[model samples]
Target chain A: MDPSEVEFLAEKEVVKIIPNFSLDKIYLIGGDLGPFNPGLPVDVPVWLALNLKQRQKCRILPPEWMDVDKLEDVREMERKEESFTPPPSPYYMELTKLLLNHASDNIPKADEIRTLVKDIWDTRIAKLRLSADSFISQQEAHAKLDNLTLMEINTTRSFLLDSLNCMFKLRSNMQPGSGTGKALDY
Target chain B: MDSQSYLPVPPGVGMEENFLSLDDILLSHERLPSRTECLFPRLGYLEKTSDSQDIMEGTKMELPLWLAKGLYERKRRVVSVELPKVYREGWRTVFSADPTVVDLHKMGPYYYGLGSQMLHFDSPENPEIAQALLQTFIGRFRRTMDSSQNAYNEDTSALVDRLDCLERVLFRMGQSGLNSFQGWEKGRASHLTTSALVLNYRKRKMADLQA
Candidate 1:
């Protein structure tokens, strides 16, 4: 899938925003939005939050996990673990990029948070590659991808799947008649 | 990614060849060393080295893989296909020692495809040959994966120099995945873009006008 499409999915994640203008409770398809009062925080999807923040109609409250200290802890835990640790959020990478890019004014230590998140991402990708290599080398039939975020998986999906397919075909060549007789593989 | 009119058929890496795959077609054309088991009455023109009207029995000649495959039989050998030099014991040892060092592009560009096809002919070392083919791929896979994924927005001719045709396909897949993700990270993928088909169509019209 396209990275932009993944980003679009991330936009559905809700965030807290404080509006400067009062609006009567707006009802819509997904759910009721809110009676957004000036200086009062209301939960809204990232798409609407970014739109309101862009119009100078609201102040975006960065997610609780977006703090630099918390991310530093997550980064440390990620480096110490061999397997994937649960991510801060399913769309952490996308949310971090979007929020920091659009609402850095409200997010304290935005630059530091960006760097920490990037470090965590790099660490996770390295572990992912390492595990993939072992999985191929051992010729294992299946693997569970626990705690891997969509953005992370999207980066390596094509390469990993293609290699696995090639390896399977090459391995099947070992049996004299198996290559042709194995109609079930398709 | 470059715009293609249609998806090209992928090479079948094992014994069965894809009928429409361009790679498989070229692979079938690769010459194999063979010896005629019986005499040919009027097919002497095929043997350019001799002036005889009939090809003598046991006449050694090179035959394309398709022709060799058709004539070869177990019970009565009309023709005998020899193992290609690269798949013989000497090269098999080299591959077993370390597959990553050898240049498969210079060797059989269709290394995996042809190697699998070689299995059709009965030989004492058939098992060894198959083992070596699988091992060679397994040994060289890591380098192919790493180089393809890491080399972004740069000339990849050097990176792909030693890769076999099959490995090259894997490399291209890796590159596309990496390129798309990198483009999105730089905030470039969100913009509205013209389809590559439309852009190429414009170029085609310009070429027609010039002609």
Candidate 2:
């Protein structure tokens, strides 16, 4: 697997243990994992976190930024911003998707978080589409952007690049003497 | 000219006629040899022995970005990735001079894409470095175009106009460096056993050589 895939998994929510029996510290190739106790919470990779949750050995703590109120605030901010706001984490969107799919049972207010994240995503996408429209209409040859998260850029890349490339062709063709020098130009 | 034969074939059809396709540009760019020192501990998955290293922790070994990224992500303790020499020097030049006068394409099409991807994840604090560089570059680029006092003949000016259009497209495209490795491309590579085959077949082929 690509390292990014592994890193994405590593950045997920830390799992909290609700231990039934005592366990010794376990070591893995990556690093020492735990001296797991009855009520201690430790950050863990998503794969291990999900495994522990399934075995009833641990309860996962949703990331601090994953709360319903926080997400709603982010959604509102995105709707109002002229440009993108930096996401809480570079992998915020992906982390949300992973947790929702694999550990929803452990999350507090999973449904609301889902909705809020969706709203934020939809609003930002709508903003991107609007900016693209204005760009084409105004025939501004260049775009200036800041604060876009990695995920937002990924979602808009195809549409943005395709439109810009199309505009490039349009601008070039509209030039005089396009086809046959003085007599013709394509 | 026959009016009946006139057809709107669109303009700028020849814009890239003499230039390499995006895919080709990426392929040749990938062929360049480079290396970087790893500043963290990383695990290595050995394909042949199928035996993996528990950790490669050090600043001693120099490796490519693909390998370095894997190790870095597994346990960022494994290796620290650095900006390669070509780009480091290129930026030094851009920063020291009027960015507008610098040719954005001097480093090649893959410069922004590869540079941003390597830096963003590995060096989180500077994720926006690529965009900042491009913003300055385009600012100056546009300024030069606006200030030109009929610097070239009509033919040359037309070519310059086309180049301006191309530069913008590339700059914007470069902003989303990681996009090239994600989405449709990722989907294609998901079939791990066949991905190598797919890549080989995807390369451009030229035929018809006569002595």
Candidate 3:
């Protein structure tokens, strides 16, 4: 699929999962301040979908017009900033755990679960645009559970685990050091 | 020598009706100095009652004179200030010359000033009259409760309970007073009449908001 098409699909996927998600903003990190270099790897925008606590849960997207074959070179560009430990992607870690847990249960409601996860991600993205202060720790994320009704608590837990599992599986499928490679080891 | 052996009435000491009308009771010079004095008799009455009871019962309940004077003066001022706005123009025009009289009309809305008499008045002999006096207190308590925004809080709940107790005491007094005179009915009728005034105030506020 075209990189733009993939980004668009990913954005849609995020909204489909999380209710009350807005798509006006996405966070981007690590890129050269020059013209697009088709010869060398182009930069990618790291999309972190977050919940109210700003805990993120989505994969990074390559810059516009970049081909998949250039995915290897794109990964190298990201590695330069990899040393800084781009604040543990609360987005990826959370969503991946949720999806993985859901998939393990062999639940038929995986699609429903995915939708809520996406809604949360989209909300996070919208919040980031409105607020740079995105990303919350697990403790803060769990604290949010207190505010949820009893029913929401149970459903959200399962949904979160399922999303996390799916992200992990997607990471394993992609080649190492590829554009959509595994998130930071931590 | 038994108290129960005594006849209902000693023929010579007949009970004379002191049938004071609302105007007579409130405006009488015999019990009070005048209309202005009647507006704040609770201040002096409380002092005298406290001192006499202290001497007879061997316990001082009388507040210090300075404090008593300060409280009475403050209460009088509050009543004098509010009475004019609350009372009809005609009622106030009568006492317009006397600033103290005008003050009484101005502070009429704060009937709680008289209601505060519960803080000091403690005559066990006139328990019936004392209970009737509590009606003014209960009225003030209810007004304060309804006017406050956060009446649901713990502190407010305690205050409300105290107010309710005062109301119950007043109701008991009303029941007892009914045996003597039909006048208690008129006083009871006027208790919640101020609610209409408050409702009108609220409507005006809403109109102002829309404007």
Measured by TM-score, the strongest candidate is 1
Candidate 2 on A1-186: residue-level lDDT in tens? 232453355455454545444578889887777777777776567678767777777777787898888887787777777787767566676677667767898788898887788788667656765665566556687887666556666545643565455445434433323422422111
lDDT of candidate 2 over B1-211, digit per residue (tens): 0112223222122222212344323322332232333422244543232244533333244454445444444233534556654356566556446554545444434443444334423344342454443444334443332222122222333323423334444333332333333432234323434343454564454653332
DockQ for all models? 0.59, 0.01, 0.00
Say which prediction, candidate 2 or candidate 3, comes out ahead on lDDT: 2
Badly placed stretches (over 4 Å) of model 2 are: A1-32, A141-145, A169-186, B1-12, B16-211
In model 1, the runs with Cα more than 4 Å from the true position are A180-186, B202-211
TM-score of each: 0.94, 0.43, 0.16
Q: Model 3 chain A — which ten-residue stretch has the worst lDDT?
A: A131-140
DockQ of 3: 0.00
- RMSD to the true structure for each prediction, in A, is 3.1, 25.1, 31.1
For residue B138, give model 3's deviation from the true position in Å.
Answer: 3.5
**Relative to the unseen true structure, what is the C-alpha lDDT of residue B117 in candidate 3, on a scale of 0 to 100?**
23
Query: Tens-digit lDDT track for model 3 on A152-181?
Result: 222123223332332232222222233211
Q: lDDT scores for all predictions? A: 0.89, 0.50, 0.27
User: How much native contact recovery, as a fraction, does model 3 achieve?
Assistant: 0.00
In candidate 3, position A139 carries an lDDT of: 11
